[model samples]
Target: MIIGSSERVPLEKCPALVLNADFRPLSYYPLSLWCWQDAVKSVFLERVSIVSNYKRKIRSPSFEMSLPSVIALKNFIKPTEHPSFTRFNVFLRDKFTCQYCGDKKDLTF
Candidate 1:
């Protein structure tokens, strides 16, 4: 379990969902998630604004607050209008299946 926090949740138990300035997910196919450390750092750096938070809290001699569950970038980043051809892109386009075998299980590569 992690320390110096109000909640004793394991570090891996919570990850903040990251979003673009428009409030849409940064990446839909894989879903953008940032670890707690990065989330907190982004908050402190003012690179991102917290949209939502978990009940869990972290504390320091100087400050104490809940961990962000969702965050959005302060500046907008445009997504590409077209996706490049790659194996991962192909899988996302194909819904992660082996087209020839019709196998959708664990097509991770």
Candidate 2:
């Protein structure tokens, strides 16, 4: 399906923070997220409930709705004992600080 163009949203701001049915983030390590398109799709599908909204609204000829800032699933999902390994996860699990010097900026793998 066609996604956004430059004329639409500024890509960076359109991401929604995805939460589990319990209302906590789906994944704390990665700061669970979904793009605007996916968030909107889930809303229409009744798979998620909007917990918060951004001021911006997207409009088409037939409808309009504010972009979701936060969303939670309708069904609870059990979290795994071991979260998947990923760059963001690693950073998050480590608390985003350099272990050696305690610097909180410019971290990298």
Candidate that would win on TM-score? 1
Candidate 2 residue-wise lDDT, 20-108, digit = tens:
89898877655898999999999999999998887777789999988787899999999898878887777777889888899998888
Q: Which residue pairs in candidate 2 have backbone atoms (N, alpha carbon, C) closer than 3 angstroms, thus clashing?
A: none
lDDT of model 1, residue 83: 82
Which parts of model 2 are misplaced by more than 4 Å? Answer: 1-12, 84-108
For model 1, how does the per-residue alpha-carbon lDDT over 2-96 read when each residue is reduced to its tens digit? Answer: 22334667767889999999999988877999999999999999999998888788789999988888899999999989887889999888888
**Model 2, TM vs. native:** 0.70
Clashes of each: 0, 0
